[model samples]
Target: MTQPVSKTSVLAGMTSRALVIAALVVIVAACLPMVLSSYQVGLATEVLIFGVLAMSIDILAGFAGRTSLGHGAIFGVSTYVVVYATGQAGLSPWAGFALGVLAATAVASVFALLAVRTSGVYFPLLTLALGMIVWGVCLRWTQVTGGENGMRADVRPAALMSHSAFYWAVLAGAVVVSFAMWRFVRSPFGLTLRGIRDSESRMRSLGYNVPLHLFIGFTVSGIFAGIAGGLYAMFNNFVSPSTVALAQSVEGVLMMIAGGVGTLFGAFVGAAAIIVLENIVSSYTERWLMVLGITFVLIMIFAPEGIIGKLRAITSRKVR
Candidate 1:
């Protein structure tokens, strides 16, 4: 008879595989700027920033079973704070980055307090309402946010002025954020999150403070999203009301879904696919939105498990 595999051995094998894949990714990212044009490098940077946002979404929507539509608000709050601190307050870039992250964490905390008690559809609805509030604020706050005109600030330091340099910086940040998130999701706390997601009532009966765990998870997600926002602001050197719009939040969720909801690194794959396809499609057509919708429909219909999820399933089967 075949012996049952030990969990420890399985975990060790998975860790080794992950390390190898991470090394390959880093090497590829390092070489990308050397081959791509300036515009392409900028697009790659956006992918990394947006990938981080999607990964944050994964932490909430994937692990915690709490989908947040207000994450755009949390993200945009960071961007606006960074711009205001660096441009209006004339603070250094590093200081502004810190402030931006703090603002995002604060907003996320407020959101968690209001919505963490709810579950299922109500949580998403509450988050959507909160997101709309932020969008309206961005529209009406004429002085600080610059209203519809938005805010512009070049926060890049002298060392990262070149496109390649900026790309490398963003890549490094992405790697760090990804590593931290990977560790978080593998920790015991993360296991509690998954347990909560699987059965909230059961976890509660097990003496877990479900709401508190959710709150902490949301805050952690916000921190990652805020990091992405700070990077994006530095990349674009501008922020507008659209940054806080519902569509932004929707797209982040979509990226998570398309890449494989619970798979952390899938966010990068989905971000790269969507960003590159959007750019390519927009270059040829005026109705890229329709195309994007159709593409989403196709993905849902044909690959419901998402690109990475499907690949993982196939790999597992082949290994068996």
Candidate 2:
């Protein structure tokens, strides 16, 4: 008879494969600037930023079972804070970064405090309302936000003026954020969050503070979103009301779904797909949104678990 395979050995092999794949991905990312045009490099950087945002959404939607529509508020708040600090207050880029993240944390905390008690459709509705509030503020806060014109701030460090340098900086940030998120989802706290997601009442009966855990998760997710927002602002050297709109939050969630809801690195895959599609499809037709909607519908019908999740399932079946 064939020897029985040990689960530990199987896990070890999977881990080894994952590490190798990760290293290969990094090598490819590092080489993109050499082959791509400046605009394409910028698009790549946008993918990294939006990937982080999508990962943050994964934290809440996949792990915490809380799909927030207010994340755009948190993201926009951070972007505006960074713009204010860097442009209006004349602070250093580092200082703006700190303040921007802090602002996002604060907004997330408030949203969590008010909304975590609700679940299901109510949760999303509450978050949508809260996000609309932020959008209204961005539109009306003319003195600081520049009204509809938006605000511009050069948050890029002098050393990163070149497109290649900025792309590398964003790539480095994406890598660090990815690693941190990976650790987070695998940590004990992360497992607790997942447990709570699976059965909130059961976890509560087991003496877990469900609301507190969700609140913390939401805040942490917001921090990652904030990081993405700051990077986005730096990339465009501008912040506008559009950044904080409901559409922005929806796009982030869409990216999460497209990539694979729970798989952290899958967010990048989704981001790349969406960004590349937008660039390529828009050039050919003005009906890009229609195409995107059709694509999403098709994915929902054919690959509901997402691109990465589908691939994982195929790989597992092959291994079996």
Candidate 3:
């Protein structure tokens, strides 16, 4: 008779599988420098940066059951802060980065304070209104923000000025953000967030602080989004109102939905797919937006659970 596998064996197998996947990713990122052009590398770096942003949205929509349509404002505000500190104030890159992230976190905390009072659609609308306030400041305060023309500043230190050097730095930051978020979502706090997401009433009856947990989750997510903004400003050496626009917010939502909300891995996958479709496909076709729309529709229709969710379903079946 064939022996059945033990639970320990299954756990060990899963652990090994995860390690192998991580190794493969590292190897691929390492080798890209050899084959990819400078521009291509920059583009790839952008995908990773935006992947961090998408994951932030996932933390809210996926884990907390709170969706914000104005998340781009948080990202943009941080970027602007970094740019101002570095260019206008002559602060060091590291200092600028610190200030930028903290500022974003502060902004997020303020928003969360009020947003947590509301639920469902109201939360998102409140966020949207608040975000528009930031945009208005950026636009009207031309003397400081440069208004519509935007501001240009080199945020990279001399050592990281090279394309490859900057890409590696960004890659490191992205990796840290990804690992930190992964650990967080698997923690007790993350579990609490999930309970709230599933049913706030049930969690409240259990004596859980539902609003508090959601506010914390939202604030934490904003920090990561801020980090992405910092990297983006450094990468492009430009900060503008465009980064905080409604269109950018919509794109972030689209990314989370496409990748499988709640899956950190799915967020990155979705970012890659959307960035590739937008950047690569647009080079050859004038109707890239239409193509992207079609792709999104198809994914929603055929794989509503998202790429990662579908894969998990397959893996579970095979294991069983």
Candidate 4:
């Protein structure tokens, strides 16, 4: 009585569905500033910045299988570089951004070279130590960084005109970075990285340079994080040691885990959820970190695969 769906038809349907969803997202974001306050738009911009940071973490943790607990250091270093170059050295903001990315990438390469020698918990601890060292430098080096008082910048370039314009700029950056990351993960190099993740011994047996691949991945991820950090500094017109704290590193990990380890959409969702929840919780009490900790624990225990992964599982089961 009814015709079955052909493979081509099914694929087209899925593609159409994705386009519809993407269109809806853009429409909503474009209209949000009209209905929301400037403060709300500013908060949304922060969430987008975190989304970029989370995606960088995902590239290492999900694709390269290298879990870094020190991304906040890289992030902080980038922000400081931007502030120092533009604010102190009198370079253009664009030049400062490029230099920041280069610095972060170079640092990541060195760190990865040392870190790739270790594995599992040792790698994470190594990164944690690196992060703490950076934090200490930021705190103790008061002259350049302004120490605990932090550093501030003037307004961003004219491209970012209003609060809404800045929000859109951040969102556009997030989308571009996300797309590039998605493409990287779907490439042959990405497959090789996955091979390393699955089995370093096997990859080496096949004559693949496992450590080299990881180092490259780490460096690339750091560059992306640097871009996010530079944008954050510009958006807020400030940077501080607190921005690179251990808590911020943990937040990046939490965003990745909460969204779905290997899924790109998961990172965005997790960033949004965490930021929204933080804003709400902090309004009621200063001890909001306690609530966030408990929430993370519960999410780990109950929704271990994350919202996106779980949704996929449900959809797959239904289709079957």
Candidate 5:
């Protein structure tokens, strides 16, 4: 009754769909500055930063199958690096960004070295404990981090002062980072990581150093998280201990899970959804966290694999 589709036809359809989506994203992003207010552009910047953080989580959780609960600590360390280097040390913002990345990478390597030795729940708990220690240091280290008052950048860089420039910069950074991550997921190392994720014992038996691979992945993810944190601190011109709180780490996990754990685009979608919902719901009451928790539970019960995953499943069924 129906004509069967060939492999060529399916490939062509996928390519065409991807192209259309790419074009749409470009068009929308290009037009947003013209249509939206500067405040809205600022909000978009926050979304992009959160998207980066979410993607970092995806790198570990989705690809490497490593559940980390201390990513917010890495992010906070970067933020503090930027603030301390640029604001207090009187270095250039660019130098601050580099230092932030270095700091995050160093911390991540140490964390991975210790955390990767364990698997499952212990790994996450170890990271969480480490993150809390970092938070405690930030809170108590008054001379360096400004304690509860937080640290502020003396000035915003010239390039980021303009709303349009900042918007474009953030958008470009997000796109480039996302593309790099996508490529990483398609590489040999990425395939090996997936293999490790599926069965670490099997990978070890195959002569792969599982801990080494995880450590590398963790460090890479931390570098990206640091970059995101640098952008966030620059945009806000402030860094605080609260930025590295356990709650923030939990939020990152939630964003990745809600978006679609293994899908790259899902991170962006989840960040956008969470940001928009938070903004709207907070306008009504301070109990938005309660609402958010309930909503998350509902989604977990109804769409465990997430919105994108559910859509993909539906599409596959239709094709079948």
Candidate 6:
């Protein structure tokens, strides 16, 4: 009894839906600080921070088809750099920010020297080892990272002295980074990466430097992870081994998978879902992790591609 949807009509519908979603997000951002409690707003800020981290991992795992378990090291390293730059060296917050991100990029590039040659389980294993090495450093290097106690590094500028102000800054950062990522994933370079993901040998036969492309993508992903880390350092005003732990790396991967792999917007969705449960559900029960694990299993059973992927599937079905 239903009419078939033409391709033109489906395209128009998708565009309209995207515009509505964008407008709604803008409205929420504008109203959040005024409506939410300080603690809630701070939690939201954390979501955005982790969203950036998850999105970075998504770029490689989703688009480039390379799963990395060492992202937390890259993230934690940046945070420590920012902390050291501002807290220990007495550098300006802005300068510390730059150095923090640069350090993360450098570390990721260095790791890529060994990782770029491998794929599949080998790449993840190498990255895991690299991550563990960084984690050990953060733990053993007491003078630099303050070991278990951690060092409180205040990197807030005069303009962002208040929590609300900092939240706005974070919101702006998330927006800019998300827009840039969205553009990058649609660009010719992104298309080439996808081609490599689909058929590495074919791309290589076409004279594409497959390893070089993957390496560059890996480094670029680290850049965003570093930015998230820098923001996290300033936001938390602290640095420690926990930031670089293997658990945090696993969390990033879980977020990406929960939201929807290969979809940038899904990264934020996944972060929100996970962070909300951590903050809210943990308050009610001590076994929140178990509950979360159960939820993840159910989601995978019903919607393996994730919430966004499932939604896309439904939309596609409707269009058909």
Name the top TM-score candidate. Answer: 1
lDDT (C-alpha) at residue 292 in model 1: 75
Q: What clash count goes with each model?
A: 0, 0, 0, 0, 0, 0
Pick by TM-score: 1 or 6, better one: 1
RMSD of 3: 6.1
Residue 44 Cα positional deviation in candidate 2, in Å, after optimal superposition: 0.9
lDDT of 3 by residue, 1-320 (tens): 00111222343343666755765676677577679999889888888888899999888988888888778888888999999999999999989999999989999899889999999899889999998888889988999999999999988888998888888877777766777787678789999999999999999999998888988999999998899888888988998888887667767777787788888767778888788879878888888658866876887788778777778889999999
The predicted structure with the larger lDDT, 3 or 4, is 3
Tell me the tens digit of each residue's lDDT in model 5 across 54-172: 88988999998887899999988988898889999999998988898899889888888898898988988999999999999999999989999999885358867898788887787
Pick by lDDT: 1 or 4, better one:
1
TM-score for each predicted model, relative to the true structure: 0.91, 0.90, 0.88, 0.89, 0.90, 0.89
Error (Å) of candidate 4 at residue 114 is 1.5
| Candidate achieving the largest lDDT | 1
Deviating ranges (above 4 Å) for candidate 5: 1-20, 311-320
In the order shown, what is each candidate's alpha-carbon RMSD? 5.8, 5.9, 6.1, 5.9, 6.1, 6.3
lDDT by residue (tens digit), candidate 2, 68-104? 8888888889999999899999999989989999999
Superpose all Cα atoms of candidate 4 onto the true structure and report the RMSD in Å to 1 decimal.
Answer: 5.9
Superposition error at 246 for model 4 (Å)? 1.0
lDDT scores in order: 0.87, 0.87, 0.83, 0.81, 0.83, 0.85
lDDT of 4 at 2: 10
* Ranking of predictions according to TM-score: 1, 2, 5, 4, 6, 3
Could you give candidate 6's per-residue lDDT for residues 75-120 as a string of tens digits? 9999999999999999999999999999999999988878889988
Model 4 reaches what TM-score against the true structure? 0.89
lDDT of 4 at 148: 95
Error of 6 at 214 (Å): 0.6
* lDDT measured at residue 284 in model 2 versus the true structure, 0 to 100: 91
